[model samples]
Target: MMLPGFPEAAPLAGLAGGLLIGLAAALMLLGAGRVTGVSGIVGRAFGINDSGMSWSSAWTFVIGLPLGAFLVATLKGGFEPEFVPLPLLAVAGVLVGFGARLGSGCTSGHGVCGVSRLSQRSLVATATFMIAGIATVAVMGAL
Candidate 1:
């Protein structure tokens, strides 16, 4: 099967984004001594569990997710991503949520923080994640 190719991958933008993410995650770890895991932060914000960070702080981090995106969109003259069908999007979201639960954290948590700490589990989990995403794209394209 011939899969749709994304020849427009923006390497510079991707590198900049990755560096920013690493810087943010590193600052969170060094300054706060907490992993900047979105799921963990958001869960704490909602009082799911008591973590080292304060509830307000956790919520602040959660809010930054969208605010940062908006800031980037504004600077980039608006962000336009390829739109997936709504139904497919919903299903993908559900699957992501389930995967997060099963994995104990979101990709940002394990992929960024955990891997940086040289965690064996995070390395395995990140590998599984990439594999799953590639497989999903392949299967969906085949359909």
Candidate 2:
């Protein structure tokens, strides 16, 4: 449903998505005894790191992310999303990868799992992520 002040906001859809994400994260942790960390899983899938998880399993999870999105978009008759140029996307991806490595875990891992467990590092990392995101938006808007 649309939000009052935000014409394009779909609160129900967002809530449903959030619930699904939480359920998936919880299932991943309980069923596999692993945090749903995309970056680490991607690394493992690519043989960049050994995390005791099977390569095929990691790859399946990584692939499912976009596949799920595609399914949803298709079911909804698709949407036109404006994306930056390939070069900018490549640069952004590299920077995000570097940041995830430096931070020891990505948002899903630290923010969702670790924070749920009340880990200090995850709390700090999540705060840092939020702050950086806000600052980036402010700066970009000002430009």
TM-scores, all models, native as reference = 0.82, 0.90
Q: Candidate 2: list runs displaced more than 4 Å.
A: 1-9, 81-83
Candidate 1: the clashing residue pairs are: none
lDDT tens per residue, model 1, 60-136: 99888999899988897887777899999999878877788789888999999999899998899999999988999
RMSD of 1: 3.6
Q: Which ten contiguous residues of candidate 2 have the minimum total lDDT?
A: 1-10
Using lDDT as the measure, which candidate wins? 2
**Model 1 global lDDT (CA atoms, 0 to 1):** 0.86
lDDT score at residue 129, model 2, on the 0-100 scale: 96
lDDT of each: 0.86, 0.90
Tens digits of per-residue lDDT, candidate 2, 1-143, equal: 55467746477778889899899999998899998888899999999887678999999999999999999999988979888999999999999899999999899888888899999999999999999999999999799
